[model samples]
Target: MVLQSNVRPGLTQGLIALMAAACGFAVANVYLNQTLLVDIAGTFGAAEAEAGIVTTLTQVGYALGNLLIVPLGDIFERRRLILALLGVVSLSLVSAALSGSLTWLIVSNFCLGLTTVIPQIIVPLAAGMADERNRGKVLGTVAIGLVCGILGARLVSGLVDSLWGWRSMYWISFGCMLLLALLIRLRFPVSKGTASLPYRRLLLSLGPLFMKEDVLRRSCLSQGMIFGSFSVFFTTIGFLLQAPPYSYSSAVVGLVGLVGIGGAIATPIIGRVIDRKGASFANKMCMLAALISFLIAVTAGHWLPALILAAFLLTVGTQANQVACQANIFSLSASARSRLNGLYMVCTFLGGALGSYLGVWAWTRWHWTGVCICGMVMIAAGMSAALGTKNGGNSHKR
Candidate 1:
């Protein structure tokens, strides 16, 4: 097995910045629709429950793409593979732009999720491109872009849709994807993959690897639950904000994401603690913080200030938990980074998809409080798994 810092070539700042932009743009697709969910439902004359499928299916597609497309990074030339995926992503974005019906929009969004797996590919590429000295810095810079993309997409989409129309915003996204694809195809360096395994064998190895790696399993469980809890809130926050207690516009709903930037800023601080102490310590603290976030969010239905506080805590805790967990899991195998990432993302997003579906369901039945309870339950379940599992186990052999 090759170590990432040893075999993979380090990257330049210019390349890193480009990669950061690409990562943000790709990830923003899934999240851009969160604040726009209300307007979308209104457009199609659908219920909140039905419109929630947009987020749910998009997340499910992301999980599917992670499982299927991301593993190819280990099997193919990274640059060519990325460009190919970007081509398909561009097509999906264009399809989203042209969508006339809710079903069409939903289908287009799912495809967007599938092809937008580019960021996952890019992350391992960034890791491959960084040496020990700048590894964290490179990754952190790119990560901030991704965080901003996730939060900022809402504001852009909301403002665009409010000013122009929903279709126009998607058209803009479509053009951006096309432009990025062309630029990357021209500029990205060619890269050879390190893995020697055949396609079928590589795909088959994941289950056993999951069984064998305690760190991977524990991290997946902890991250899955935490991310699920996080998704539950995002999927339903629109519902809460659009109703009578607040009656905020979709544009106003999107502004709430600005609040999450406060959380994104805490990432470096969290990383420092992880370096000094351990990922386990950081995750435990995040779990407690998440619990508090959910508790605070219970009042968000009535109080906007409480809602802002809740969003900050949830984003901060979720970010730390994700970073800490990935650090633990990725430490297990450098050679298998792509496949390990595929598995990790699949687990995480499966939890996210489940949470999206159940969150809307809970909101339908019991409103905002139900969503808060779900978040707390996920935290409890994740903590239980973390406590029950052993740490520092052997890495898997393929």
Candidate 2:
């Protein structure tokens, strides 16, 4: 077993927990608008199709931020950059809350997405600071916050919209962002190990880095596929739950986010596995679990418990696979940690967008069974890519 001592020692569980909470807080901004589209449309007197632009612009901003801003972590002081971005996020949220027109809301949401790269920065920082012995565990712990934010934002936004109206959600998140910025300034340690490369060079380096690294390429594709499949399930589950035998309400659909906790809780446990058995073990299980979950979901359409179990399994697999892939990615280039991470995120988000689009299309055409089939195919594709990489190993990186 080899341990890499890369950064100065100061990481603690308390700091880890705060970092996790901050990440959850920051990343939640991307999703807050998802559940509020209807109310927003009503308030602005916009059509449903026009209102959909809010989510579209948010997603675009997120992708652009991942590509453009995240790599700056390797150039600037990470904590300072984070604090600055938190300020941007706070301003964006407030602007969103006070938006007077659809156009203002759209631009504000885009800015909100652009600056919410804090979680991405924090993840690589956690990996860069920890040795292989504890890297997976730290990343996993932080992922709990990231994953929770990803799954829980819709619930929070939906609840707040019901209670006070859509704008209130932004106001709450806005206040929370300010508090997180303060706590981060006070508690998070400064880590700036990257060379003083020019910003253009820093950005340019990502291209060759992505093209040249076998491990990174593999990590991106494998996780991208799994996340794509994960997206498929979440994207279409509400439709399934609302129709036919289980005709549940939208609130009940929101409760389904709770099922995703299976993955959140399993993340650290999976990290332990990556530590003891290597990340490959977790990666393998990720593909397998995803494949199995889809099979179960396909047959269990009429049974609520079965569908819930399928959702749980799908989340566990995707989350575990992601943690393992990311643990490996962070190890690949200590100095390039943020760049690698940013690229990984960009790929996976693209995959998720693809899955969301495809899933909706499948549901529109063939309903539940079609959605399950599409998810299964994506997971299978990931598994196939993994198998072709090496003998007895898709996690050929570690």
Candidate 3:
């Protein structure tokens, strides 16, 4: 087995934990608006439809961050970039917590989304730090932290919103972001091997990546589809659970997201499998899990147990497939891994923006069935995209 040298010598596992936590906290900014949409709408005297725009704009901000901000990972020192973005996120959260109108809230959410690229930078950094023999494990560990952060955000946001008010969640996250930024600065070693490309070349090189690399293209598409489907579920679930048949509280609806932890836990295991046996087998199984989850969800009305199980399977499958896609991309490009990640995540977040809008539209039009159809079709589209690439092979640049 081949081993990759640690990017920095004398880096302790404790520092790695701190780095991953920073990424986790940073990424959690993206979803903080989702669980609180209703409360936010009422607070701002906006209609539910207008409040939905909060989610859309935040996703749009994330998409923009990926396209415009994350590419800088190749051109700048990663630690400085991470800390800078953390500062942006911290400030944005503070502003969001203080917003007096829907418009101001939306603007702040967009800023938060645009600046929250720390996870994207950190994930590739972690992969590069470990050798092929343990890359999957290292990625898995970081991914676990990220997954928990993503899920935990909803839980903490809900609990805090319940006690202090929804706005306080942002204030709390603001504090977390500040502490994380300081800890990362003091603890994590600087990445000595940061890509030294000029910004012009870094931006222009993405053109060939799209035109030439089938792996980059397909992986981006697959993640987009999976994330799109996932977005639809969470976006519209609030509407469903709050409607006539269920009428669950916001906290309970948030608890429902806890089911997604199954996927968080499954990510590293799937990473291990992708490490041993190529993604061929795992990809297909993940797709199957998504399809099955959709099938069960379509039939589950008033059957709370069935609906929760379906949600679990759907999240687990999507997250596992996402890890596989990232692992494959990392395997393909040693030098441009961060840019590759930036490209894929940008596309995925774009898809999520589209999905969240579509889910709300579908729910408004045809209710839960509409959202379910959106999920199934998107997942199917993702599966077809992955199938278009060679299953047992790797692509190389000339």
Candidate 4:
């Protein structure tokens, strides 16, 4: 079946920005707990390593949701699916805010992840609607929203936690999700399903999709590794900052997310690069930026400036690499975009879950040095995947 957009002949700037904002707001729920990990640990009288499980479990749930729920986008009306997910996530945030114990919070957060698949669904929707000429740029615009939500979650959560408490952050997120759901209902066009396959067939197709598409495979492997490294740095950085020489507060540590705004600002330009120079070229450059980020992060234990610089580079790398990979896979099959996205993101967040675990584990045993080693190894593995793929001449043709 041929997919169609009912909105208008071309996507307007206002609508694009709205979609971007929606993506940012939806994805922020997943990372809100990162900056508050230290405070959460103190609240529950649990070790920091134990507190880190909140982040790990959230990613694991996200991966599972991507695998199981995101594929439904292709079989159901997208606007309804997205709104239903938003409602579920809002309830999860409330559950998180009211948690009386760490175990309760962990379970709430996992539920939060399970319902937070809205952004993944929206991304493919936007990509499918865009013309090939502007697909990369549009994807980048949406990516900017996703990146900001990710980085901004830390900043907002930290500030809210410092001002009120960690629980207050969840309350704020719940409000934000409700507001976003209202906006989506009012503003988003009704987009119908593109495929006629049964739910079971949709689920069954994902494995063959992964096995059949080379671009999908490479994009998944490389982006998954980079996302793992991205998770490693973020999951443990709060712990590092709250202790040791700097001894900064959660709010102060969250300022590091502001540094990442530089990366977000650069995403559209990277999107254009992917459009002109191809995903292969952009992928290589992004991997190099990540490599440098971790190298600088090794010195972050003693120097504040190094940590800030590393954060900026890593954000640029991960965000840009995502735009590249999405641009590559969305080009493969219009009818299968959501399924392709689901498969790609399942791998990406699984990598993130592993990185979250390793980040805490490394921090517990080897300290900052160990964390840096783990991040570098993940980046190296990603680089190997990108280097191994034969360069596609242009991403639009992929």
Q: Highest lDDT, which number?
A: 4
**TM per candidate:** 0.92, 0.89, 0.94, 0.96
Model 4 C-alpha lDDT per residue in residues 1-398, reported as the tens digit of each score: 12323333546676788888998988898999999999999999999989999999999999999999999999899999999999899999999999999999999999999889988999998887788877888888888899889999999999999999999999999999889988989878888889999999999999888999988888888999999999999998888888878788999978876688777877888888877878777888999999999999996546888888999999999999999888888888889889999999999999999999999999999989999999999999989878876565345643
Best by TM-score: 4
Off by over 4 Å in 2: 1-8, 37-53, 99-104, 242-247, 389-398
Whole-model lDDT values for every prediction: 0.79, 0.80, 0.80, 0.89
Better of 1 and 3 by lDDT: 3
Off by over 4 Å in 3: 1-12, 395-398
Per-residue alpha-carbon lDDT of model 2 for 26-60, expressed as tens digits? 98888777567667878999865566567656766
Order of candidate numbers by TM-score, starting with the best: 4, 3, 1, 2
User: CA RMSD for every model?
Assistant: 3.8, 3.7, 3.0, 3.0
Candidate 4 lDDT for residue 142: 83
lDDT of 3 at 77: 76
lDDT of 3 by residue, 8-29 (tens): 4443477557656876788788
- Candidate 2 — number of clashing residue pairs? 0
> Candidate 2, overall lDDT?
0.80
The digit string of per-residue lDDT tens for model 1 on 29-139 reads 888877778888889999888888988999999999999889888879988898888788778878877878989999999998887888888877776666533444455
